[model samples]
Target: MASAPPAGQGQQGAAAAASPLAPSEMYRNYNFLLRLDSTEVRFTECLGLGMRIEPIRYRESGVGNVVRALPGPVAYAEVVLRYGLATTPDLWNWLKRTAEGAVVRRNVTISQLDNDGATPRINWNLYGAWPCQWSGVPFDALGREAAIEELRLAFDRLDRA
Candidate 1:
Protein backbone atom coordinates (compact mmCIF):
# COMPACT_ATOMS: atom_id res chain seq x y z
CA MET A 1 0.00 0.00 0.00
CA ALA A 2 1.10 3.58 -0.70
CA SER A 3 1.23 6.20 2.05
CA ALA A 4 -0.66 9.57 1.77
CA PRO A 5 1.21 12.81 1.13
CA PRO A 6 1.97 15.45 3.82
CA ALA A 7 -0.79 17.43 5.48
CA GLY A 8 -0.41 20.62 3.38
CA GLN A 9 0.88 19.25 0.09
CA GLY A 10 -2.53 18.20 -1.24
CA GLN A 11 -4.12 21.52 -0.36
CA GLN A 12 -1.31 23.42 -2.05
CA GLY A 13 -1.79 21.44 -5.23
CA ALA A 14 -5.49 22.28 -5.36
CA ALA A 15 -4.92 25.90 -4.49
CA ALA A 16 -2.34 26.33 -7.23
CA ALA A 17 -4.77 25.03 -9.81
CA ALA A 18 -7.49 27.38 -8.59
CA SER A 19 -5.29 30.45 -8.48
CA PRO A 20 -6.40 33.55 -10.40
CA LEU A 21 -4.72 34.66 -13.56
CA ALA A 22 -1.69 36.87 -13.12
CA PRO A 23 -1.67 40.57 -13.99
CA SER A 24 0.64 39.75 -16.87
CA GLU A 25 -2.25 38.11 -18.69
CA MET A 26 -4.08 41.46 -18.99
CA TYR A 27 -3.03 44.45 -21.07
CA ARG A 28 -0.64 46.95 -19.54
CA ASN A 29 -2.08 50.18 -18.21
CA TYR A 30 0.37 52.42 -20.02
CA ASN A 31 -0.23 50.86 -23.44
CA PHE A 32 -3.27 52.46 -25.00
CA LEU A 33 -4.40 54.29 -28.15
CA LEU A 34 -6.71 57.16 -28.90
CA ARG A 35 -8.22 58.05 -32.24
CA LEU A 36 -10.58 60.68 -33.56
CA ASP A 37 -12.81 60.40 -36.58
CA SER A 38 -12.31 63.96 -37.74
CA THR A 39 -8.54 64.15 -37.41
CA GLU A 40 -5.63 61.79 -36.84
CA VAL A 41 -4.67 63.06 -33.44
CA ARG A 42 -2.73 61.10 -30.82
CA PHE A 43 -3.23 61.61 -27.12
CA THR A 44 -0.91 60.73 -24.26
CA GLU A 45 -3.60 60.06 -21.69
CA CYS A 46 -7.31 59.37 -21.58
CA LEU A 47 -9.53 59.66 -18.51
CA GLY A 48 -13.19 59.51 -17.43
CA LEU A 49 -14.17 56.39 -19.31
CA GLY A 50 -16.84 55.50 -16.84
CA MET A 51 -20.60 55.75 -16.25
CA ARG A 52 -22.91 55.80 -13.26
CA ILE A 53 -26.47 54.63 -12.81
CA GLU A 54 -28.69 57.12 -11.01
CA PRO A 55 -31.20 55.73 -8.51
CA ILE A 56 -34.85 56.73 -8.45
CA ARG A 57 -36.59 56.53 -5.12
CA TYR A 58 -40.29 56.45 -4.31
CA ARG A 59 -42.37 56.12 -1.18
CA GLU A 60 -45.79 54.52 -0.90
CA SER A 61 -48.46 55.73 1.50
CA GLY A 62 -49.18 52.23 2.80
CA VAL A 63 -45.53 51.46 3.40
CA GLY A 64 -43.65 52.38 6.55
CA ASN A 65 -41.08 55.13 6.85
CA VAL A 66 -38.79 53.27 4.45
CA VAL A 67 -38.46 54.34 0.82
CA ARG A 68 -37.97 52.04 -2.17
CA ALA A 69 -35.22 52.70 -4.67
CA LEU A 70 -34.91 51.56 -8.29
CA PRO A 71 -32.13 51.68 -10.79
CA GLY A 72 -32.64 54.63 -13.14
CA PRO A 73 -31.00 55.64 -16.35
CA VAL A 74 -27.29 55.40 -16.86
CA ALA A 75 -25.53 58.76 -17.08
CA TYR A 76 -22.26 58.80 -18.96
CA ALA A 77 -19.52 61.01 -17.66
CA GLU A 78 -17.34 63.30 -19.74
CA VAL A 79 -13.97 62.14 -21.09
CA VAL A 80 -10.85 64.21 -20.73
CA LEU A 81 -7.80 63.70 -22.95
CA ARG A 82 -4.33 65.04 -22.36
CA TYR A 83 -1.49 65.32 -24.83
CA GLY A 84 1.86 67.07 -25.17
CA LEU A 85 1.53 70.40 -26.92
CA ALA A 86 2.60 70.01 -30.54
CA THR A 87 3.44 72.33 -33.40
CA THR A 88 0.74 71.11 -35.73
CA PRO A 89 -2.43 73.14 -35.02
CA ASP A 90 -5.26 71.02 -36.37
CA LEU A 91 -6.64 70.04 -32.96
CA TRP A 92 -6.38 73.58 -31.66
CA ASN A 93 -7.99 74.94 -34.78
CA TRP A 94 -10.92 72.60 -34.42
CA LEU A 95 -11.46 73.56 -30.83
CA LYS A 96 -11.19 77.21 -31.67
CA ARG A 97 -13.76 76.93 -34.40
CA THR A 98 -16.16 75.18 -32.03
CA ALA A 99 -15.65 77.85 -29.41
CA GLU A 100 -16.59 80.54 -31.94
CA GLY A 101 -20.25 79.43 -32.04
CA ALA A 102 -19.71 76.44 -34.33
CA VAL A 103 -20.51 73.03 -32.88
CA VAL A 104 -18.59 70.06 -34.22
CA ARG A 105 -19.15 66.47 -33.11
CA ARG A 106 -16.70 63.70 -33.78
CA ASN A 107 -16.57 59.99 -33.03
CA VAL A 108 -13.74 58.99 -30.74
CA THR A 109 -12.24 55.58 -30.06
CA ILE A 110 -9.99 54.67 -27.15
CA SER A 111 -8.41 51.22 -27.28
CA GLN A 112 -6.50 49.23 -24.73
CA LEU A 113 -3.46 47.53 -26.20
CA ASP A 114 -2.89 43.85 -25.72
CA ASN A 115 0.18 42.28 -24.13
CA ASP A 116 2.06 42.87 -27.36
CA GLY A 117 1.20 46.59 -27.24
CA ALA A 118 0.02 46.42 -30.86
CA THR A 119 -3.19 44.47 -30.89
CA PRO A 120 -6.32 46.08 -29.51
CA ARG A 121 -7.82 44.23 -26.54
CA ILE A 122 -10.91 46.39 -26.15
CA ASN A 123 -12.35 49.59 -27.59
CA TRP A 124 -14.48 52.33 -26.06
CA ASN A 125 -16.40 54.20 -28.74
CA LEU A 126 -17.81 57.65 -28.07
CA TYR A 127 -20.46 59.07 -30.40
CA GLY A 128 -21.19 62.71 -31.11
CA ALA A 129 -18.48 64.07 -28.85
CA TRP A 130 -17.82 67.78 -28.71
CA PRO A 131 -15.11 69.60 -26.90
CA CYS A 132 -16.61 71.60 -24.11
CA GLN A 133 -13.50 72.75 -22.29
CA TRP A 134 -9.80 73.22 -22.97
CA SER A 135 -6.95 73.91 -20.60
CA GLY A 136 -3.23 74.48 -20.89
CA VAL A 137 -0.67 73.30 -18.38
CA PRO A 138 0.50 75.84 -15.85
CA PHE A 139 3.90 77.37 -16.48
CA ASP A 140 6.66 77.79 -13.95
CA ALA A 141 9.79 79.74 -14.72
CA LEU A 142 12.01 77.58 -12.52
CA GLY A 143 10.44 74.16 -13.07
CA ARG A 144 10.82 72.02 -16.18
CA GLU A 145 7.85 69.93 -17.26
CA ALA A 146 6.15 68.83 -20.44
CA ALA A 147 3.56 71.24 -21.79
CA ILE A 148 0.36 69.22 -21.62
CA GLU A 149 -2.95 70.25 -23.19
CA GLU A 150 -6.25 69.01 -21.83
CA LEU A 151 -9.53 68.69 -23.72
CA ARG A 152 -12.81 67.79 -22.08
CA LEU A 153 -15.53 66.20 -24.24
CA ALA A 154 -19.24 65.80 -23.79
CA PHE A 155 -20.43 62.81 -25.74
CA ASP A 156 -23.96 61.77 -26.46
CA ARG A 157 -23.31 58.12 -25.73
CA LEU A 158 -20.56 55.65 -24.95
CA ASP A 159 -20.59 52.06 -26.15
CA ARG A 160 -18.12 49.22 -25.73
CA ALA A 161 -17.18 47.71 -29.03
Candidate 2:
Protein backbone atom coordinates (compact mmCIF):
# COMPACT_ATOMS: atom_id res chain seq x y z
CA MET A 1 0.00 0.00 0.00
CA ALA A 2 1.22 3.55 -0.90
CA SER A 3 1.19 6.33 1.64
CA ALA A 4 -0.57 9.64 0.96
CA PRO A 5 1.38 12.91 0.53
CA PRO A 6 1.57 15.40 3.43
CA ALA A 7 -1.39 17.71 4.05
CA GLY A 8 0.16 20.89 2.44
CA GLN A 9 2.29 19.03 -0.12
CA GLY A 10 -0.74 17.86 -2.10
CA GLN A 11 -2.05 21.45 -2.37
CA GLN A 12 1.31 22.72 -3.56
CA GLY A 13 1.22 20.53 -6.67
CA ALA A 14 -2.35 21.59 -7.40
CA ALA A 15 -1.43 25.28 -6.99
CA ALA A 16 1.45 24.98 -9.40
CA ALA A 17 -0.76 23.29 -11.99
CA ALA A 18 -3.42 26.01 -11.64
CA SER A 19 -0.94 28.81 -12.18
CA PRO A 20 0.19 29.77 -15.64
CA LEU A 21 3.82 29.57 -16.69
CA ALA A 22 5.84 32.73 -17.07
CA PRO A 23 6.61 33.72 -20.62
CA SER A 24 10.17 34.21 -21.87
CA GLU A 25 11.56 37.50 -23.10
CA MET A 26 10.35 38.18 -26.59
CA TYR A 27 11.04 41.31 -28.67
CA ARG A 28 8.55 43.11 -30.86
CA ASN A 29 9.32 43.55 -34.52
CA TYR A 30 8.32 47.20 -34.55
CA ASN A 31 10.89 48.00 -31.88
CA PHE A 32 13.92 48.29 -34.10
CA LEU A 33 16.24 50.91 -35.62
CA LEU A 34 18.34 51.32 -38.73
CA ARG A 35 21.74 52.96 -39.04
CA LEU A 36 23.96 53.87 -41.95
CA ASP A 37 27.62 54.24 -41.07
CA SER A 38 26.95 55.24 -37.46
CA THR A 39 24.20 57.67 -38.52
CA GLU A 40 20.83 56.66 -37.19
CA VAL A 41 18.14 56.74 -39.88
CA ARG A 42 14.44 56.60 -39.18
CA PHE A 43 12.70 54.14 -41.46
CA THR A 44 9.13 52.92 -41.34
CA GLU A 45 9.75 49.61 -43.07
CA CYS A 46 12.72 47.33 -43.75
CA LEU A 47 12.68 44.16 -45.87
CA GLY A 48 14.86 41.60 -47.66
CA LEU A 49 17.47 41.20 -44.94
CA GLY A 50 18.62 37.64 -45.62
CA MET A 51 21.26 35.40 -47.18
CA ARG A 52 21.29 32.18 -49.19
CA ILE A 53 23.89 29.48 -49.72
CA GLU A 54 23.99 27.61 -53.02
CA PRO A 55 24.70 23.90 -52.78
CA ILE A 56 26.70 22.02 -55.38
CA ARG A 57 25.73 18.37 -55.78
CA TYR A 58 28.38 15.78 -56.52
CA ARG A 59 28.14 12.08 -57.51
CA GLU A 60 30.92 9.56 -57.18
CA SER A 61 31.44 6.92 -59.82
CA GLY A 62 31.71 4.05 -57.32
CA VAL A 63 28.87 5.23 -55.06
CA GLY A 64 25.57 3.65 -56.08
CA ASN A 65 22.40 5.77 -55.88
CA VAL A 66 24.04 8.26 -53.56
CA VAL A 67 24.68 11.94 -54.12
CA ARG A 68 26.53 14.43 -51.92
CA ALA A 69 25.93 18.15 -51.74
CA LEU A 70 28.73 20.65 -51.14
CA PRO A 71 28.40 24.20 -50.03
CA GLY A 72 28.86 26.76 -52.76
CA PRO A 73 28.99 30.54 -52.97
CA VAL A 74 26.83 32.58 -50.65
CA ALA A 75 24.56 35.36 -51.87
CA TYR A 76 23.22 38.23 -49.85
CA ALA A 77 19.83 39.69 -50.66
CA GLU A 78 19.33 43.40 -51.22
CA VAL A 79 17.72 45.32 -48.39
CA VAL A 80 14.90 47.78 -48.97
CA LEU A 81 14.20 50.64 -46.61
CA ARG A 82 11.16 52.89 -46.72
CA TYR A 83 10.75 56.16 -44.88
CA GLY A 84 8.44 59.14 -44.93
CA LEU A 85 9.52 62.16 -46.95
CA ALA A 86 11.29 64.71 -44.82
CA THR A 87 13.30 67.88 -45.26
CA THR A 88 16.55 65.99 -44.85
CA PRO A 89 18.30 65.33 -48.16
CA ASP A 90 20.84 62.79 -46.98
CA LEU A 91 19.20 59.80 -48.61
CA TRP A 92 18.53 61.74 -51.79
CA ASN A 93 22.13 62.82 -52.07
CA TRP A 94 23.37 59.27 -51.74
CA LEU A 95 21.13 58.08 -54.54
CA LYS A 96 22.06 61.06 -56.68
CA ARG A 97 25.74 60.24 -56.42
CA THR A 98 25.10 56.69 -57.55
CA ALA A 99 23.11 57.92 -60.51
CA GLU A 100 26.03 60.14 -61.50
CA GLY A 101 28.21 57.00 -61.86
CA ALA A 102 30.00 57.46 -58.54
CA VAL A 103 29.19 54.51 -56.30
CA VAL A 104 29.49 55.48 -52.66
CA ARG A 105 29.49 52.37 -50.51
CA ARG A 106 28.50 52.58 -46.87
CA ASN A 107 28.06 50.23 -43.95
CA VAL A 108 24.47 49.65 -42.86
CA THR A 109 23.29 48.18 -39.58
CA ILE A 110 19.82 47.06 -38.52
CA SER A 111 19.25 46.43 -34.85
CA GLN A 112 16.37 44.87 -32.99
CA LEU A 113 15.67 46.53 -29.68
CA ASP A 114 14.20 45.17 -26.50
CA ASN A 115 10.97 46.29 -24.87
CA ASP A 116 12.62 49.53 -23.81
CA GLY A 117 13.19 50.41 -27.48
CA ALA A 118 16.67 51.69 -26.65
CA THR A 119 18.70 48.59 -25.86
CA PRO A 120 19.81 46.61 -28.91
CA ARG A 121 19.31 42.86 -28.68
CA ILE A 122 20.50 41.85 -32.12
CA ASN A 123 22.33 43.60 -34.96
CA TRP A 124 22.75 42.80 -38.64
CA ASN A 125 25.72 44.42 -40.31
CA LEU A 126 25.85 44.96 -44.06
CA TYR A 127 29.21 45.74 -45.56
CA GLY A 128 29.94 47.64 -48.81
CA ALA A 129 26.35 48.63 -49.27
CA TRP A 130 25.41 51.14 -51.95
CA PRO A 131 22.22 52.61 -53.28
CA CYS A 132 21.01 50.53 -56.19
CA GLN A 133 17.50 51.87 -56.67
CA TRP A 134 15.34 54.71 -55.37
CA SER A 135 11.67 55.45 -55.85
CA GLY A 136 9.77 58.67 -55.17
CA VAL A 137 6.41 58.72 -53.52
CA PRO A 138 3.35 58.70 -55.72
CA PHE A 139 1.26 61.84 -55.81
CA ASP A 140 -2.21 60.93 -54.60
CA ALA A 141 -4.28 64.02 -54.07
CA LEU A 142 -7.42 62.03 -53.22
CA GLY A 143 -5.76 59.78 -50.68
CA ARG A 144 -4.79 61.15 -47.26
CA GLU A 145 -1.45 59.47 -46.83
CA ALA A 146 2.04 60.60 -46.06
CA ALA A 147 4.60 60.52 -48.83
CA ILE A 148 7.06 57.65 -48.41
CA GLU A 149 10.35 57.18 -50.24
CA GLU A 150 11.86 53.76 -50.91
CA LEU A 151 15.57 53.04 -51.14
CA ARG A 152 17.08 49.73 -52.25
CA LEU A 153 20.63 48.87 -51.27
CA ALA A 154 22.94 46.22 -52.66
CA PHE A 155 25.51 44.83 -50.25
CA ASP A 156 28.50 42.62 -50.81
CA ARG A 157 28.51 40.84 -47.44
CA LEU A 158 26.26 40.43 -44.41
CA ASP A 159 27.10 39.59 -40.79
CA ARG A 160 25.04 39.11 -37.68
CA ALA A 161 26.09 40.26 -34.23
Candidate 3:
Protein backbone atom coordinates (compact mmCIF):
# COMPACT_ATOMS: atom_id res chain seq x y z
CA MET A 1 0.00 0.00 0.00
CA ALA A 2 1.30 3.49 -0.88
CA SER A 3 1.29 6.22 1.79
CA ALA A 4 0.31 9.86 1.10
CA PRO A 5 3.22 12.40 1.04
CA PRO A 6 3.25 15.88 2.63
CA ALA A 7 0.90 18.38 0.93
CA GLY A 8 3.69 20.51 -0.68
CA GLN A 9 6.62 17.98 -0.77
CA GLY A 10 8.00 16.75 -4.13
CA GLN A 11 8.82 13.16 -5.23
CA GLN A 12 12.57 13.85 -5.29
CA GLY A 13 12.62 14.83 -1.58
CA ALA A 14 10.80 11.65 -0.69
CA ALA A 15 13.17 9.56 -2.83
CA ALA A 16 16.20 11.10 -1.10
CA ALA A 17 14.81 10.23 2.32
CA ALA A 18 14.03 6.65 1.24
CA SER A 19 17.55 5.86 0.07
CA PRO A 20 19.63 4.95 3.16
CA LEU A 21 22.97 4.52 1.37
CA ALA A 22 22.73 7.61 -0.84
CA PRO A 23 25.46 10.22 -0.20
CA SER A 24 24.18 13.68 0.80
CA GLU A 25 25.74 17.09 1.37
CA MET A 26 24.32 17.15 4.88
CA TYR A 27 26.78 15.62 7.39
CA ARG A 28 28.13 16.32 10.83
CA ASN A 29 31.37 18.28 10.91
CA TYR A 30 33.84 17.40 13.70
CA ASN A 31 37.03 19.31 13.08
CA PHE A 32 37.69 20.16 16.74
CA LEU A 33 38.47 17.25 19.08
CA LEU A 34 39.01 18.78 22.46
CA ARG A 35 36.06 19.41 24.78
CA LEU A 36 37.03 21.87 27.47
CA ASP A 37 35.28 23.23 30.55
CA SER A 38 36.09 26.64 31.94
CA THR A 39 34.46 25.97 35.28
CA GLU A 40 36.90 26.19 38.20
CA VAL A 41 37.80 22.94 39.92
CA ARG A 42 38.98 23.44 43.46
CA PHE A 43 41.47 21.74 45.80
CA THR A 44 42.48 22.19 49.43
CA GLU A 45 46.11 22.68 50.33
CA CYS A 46 48.02 21.33 53.34
CA LEU A 47 49.46 24.74 54.14
CA GLY A 48 45.99 26.11 54.91
CA LEU A 49 45.52 27.55 51.46
CA GLY A 50 41.96 26.28 51.90
CA MET A 51 41.07 26.00 48.25
CA ARG A 52 43.15 25.75 45.11
CA ILE A 53 41.45 25.88 41.73
CA GLU A 54 42.33 23.59 38.85
CA PRO A 55 41.01 22.42 35.52
CA ILE A 56 41.36 18.70 35.08
CA ARG A 57 41.44 16.33 32.15
CA TYR A 58 42.13 12.61 31.79
CA ARG A 59 45.00 13.11 29.40
CA GLU A 60 46.53 10.46 27.19
CA SER A 61 49.04 7.85 28.43
CA GLY A 62 52.20 9.18 26.77
CA VAL A 63 51.88 12.36 28.86
CA GLY A 64 53.32 10.36 31.76
CA ASN A 65 56.02 7.73 32.20
CA VAL A 66 56.21 4.37 33.91
CA VAL A 67 59.89 3.46 34.15
CA ARG A 68 61.13 0.14 35.60
CA ALA A 69 64.50 -0.03 37.26
CA LEU A 70 67.26 -2.63 36.84
CA PRO A 71 67.65 -5.85 38.93
CA GLY A 72 63.90 -6.37 39.01
CA PRO A 73 63.09 -2.72 39.83
CA VAL A 74 64.17 0.21 41.98
CA ALA A 75 61.20 2.58 41.61
CA TYR A 76 58.21 3.07 39.40
CA ALA A 77 57.03 6.50 38.20
CA GLU A 78 54.09 8.58 36.82
CA VAL A 79 54.92 12.23 36.12
CA VAL A 80 52.67 14.99 34.71
CA LEU A 81 53.70 18.52 33.86
CA ARG A 82 53.39 21.53 31.59
CA TYR A 83 56.08 22.22 28.99
CA GLY A 84 58.21 25.21 29.90
CA LEU A 85 61.48 24.50 31.60
CA ALA A 86 65.16 24.77 30.71
CA THR A 87 66.45 22.06 33.09
CA THR A 88 65.29 19.10 35.14
CA PRO A 89 65.76 20.91 38.45
CA ASP A 90 63.66 23.84 37.33
CA LEU A 91 60.92 21.60 36.02
CA TRP A 92 61.11 19.56 39.21
CA ASN A 93 60.47 22.67 41.25
CA TRP A 94 57.54 23.70 39.08
CA LEU A 95 56.02 20.23 39.40
CA LYS A 96 56.48 20.23 43.17
CA ARG A 97 54.81 23.59 43.51
CA THR A 98 52.03 23.46 40.90
CA ALA A 99 50.71 19.92 41.27
CA GLU A 100 51.21 19.28 44.98
CA GLY A 101 47.46 18.98 45.43
CA ALA A 102 46.64 16.94 42.34
CA VAL A 103 49.38 14.31 42.03
CA VAL A 104 52.07 12.25 43.79
CA ARG A 105 55.15 10.16 42.86
CA ARG A 106 56.47 8.08 45.75
CA ASN A 107 60.15 7.25 45.86
CA VAL A 108 61.14 3.64 46.40
CA THR A 109 64.62 2.89 47.77
CA ILE A 110 66.76 0.00 46.56
CA SER A 111 69.51 -1.41 48.75
CA GLN A 112 73.05 -1.53 47.38
CA LEU A 113 75.35 -4.59 47.43
CA ASP A 114 77.43 -4.79 50.60
CA ASN A 115 80.72 -6.71 51.26
CA ASP A 116 79.15 -8.43 54.31
CA GLY A 117 77.05 -10.72 52.10
CA ALA A 118 76.75 -11.22 48.36
CA THR A 119 73.03 -11.71 48.86
CA PRO A 120 72.94 -8.21 47.30
CA ARG A 121 69.31 -7.69 48.18
CA ILE A 122 67.34 -4.55 47.49
CA ASN A 123 66.06 -2.67 50.56
CA TRP A 124 62.74 -2.07 48.86
CA ASN A 125 61.85 0.66 51.31
CA LEU A 126 59.34 3.43 50.66
CA TYR A 127 60.79 6.91 50.41
CA GLY A 128 58.97 10.22 49.84
CA ALA A 129 57.22 10.62 46.53
CA TRP A 130 56.26 13.50 44.25
CA PRO A 131 52.65 13.21 43.22
CA CYS A 132 52.91 15.31 40.05
CA GLN A 133 55.48 15.14 37.29
CA TRP A 134 56.13 17.49 34.45
CA SER A 135 53.96 16.15 31.65
CA GLY A 136 56.52 14.20 29.55
CA VAL A 137 57.66 15.20 26.06
CA PRO A 138 56.02 12.81 23.58
CA PHE A 139 52.73 13.17 25.39
CA ASP A 140 52.74 16.91 24.93
CA ALA A 141 53.99 16.46 21.42
CA LEU A 142 51.46 13.96 20.13
CA GLY A 143 48.40 15.44 21.80
CA ARG A 144 46.27 18.13 20.12
CA GLU A 145 47.60 21.64 20.35
CA ALA A 146 44.41 22.53 22.20
CA ALA A 147 45.97 20.76 25.18
CA ILE A 148 48.41 23.59 25.76
CA GLU A 149 45.56 26.06 25.80
CA GLU A 150 43.55 23.99 28.25
CA LEU A 151 46.58 23.28 30.42
CA ARG A 152 47.55 26.92 30.49
CA LEU A 153 44.13 27.91 31.79
CA ALA A 154 44.24 25.23 34.46
CA PHE A 155 47.75 26.22 35.57
CA ASP A 156 46.94 29.90 35.51
CA ARG A 157 44.15 29.30 37.98
CA LEU A 158 46.66 27.36 40.09
CA ASP A 159 49.10 30.26 40.07
CA ARG A 160 46.46 32.85 40.92
CA ALA A 161 45.61 30.91 44.03
lDDT of each: 0.85, 0.90, 0.33
Q: Per-residue CA lDDT of candidate 1, range 1-161, in tens?
A: 96665577796665655768655675787888888894546788888889999999999888878899999998889899999989988778778988998988899988888988789889999999888899988888887888999999988888897
Please give me the total number of clashing residue pairs in predicted model 1: 0
lDDT order of candidates, top first: 2, 1, 3
Off by over 4 Å in 2: 1-24
Clashes of each: 0, 0, 13
TM-score, candidate number 1 = 0.82
lDDT of 3 at 140: 61
| Best TM-score among the predictions, by candidate number | 2
Q: How high a TM-score does candidate 3 get?
A: 0.18
lDDT of 2 at 141: 80
Query: What are the per-residue Cα lDDT tens digits for candidate 3 across 66-109?
Result: 54333332223321223332333533553556565654333323
TM-score of each: 0.82, 0.83, 0.18
Candidate 2 residues 15-75, lDDT tens each? 6656675233667889889999989999999999999999999998999689999999999
Q: Using TM-score, rank the candidates from best to worst.
A: 2, 1, 3
Assess candidate 2 and give its lDDT.
0.90
For lDDT, the strongest prediction is 2
Candidate 2 versus the native: TM-score?
A: 0.83
Candidate 2 vs candidate 3: the lDDT winner is 2
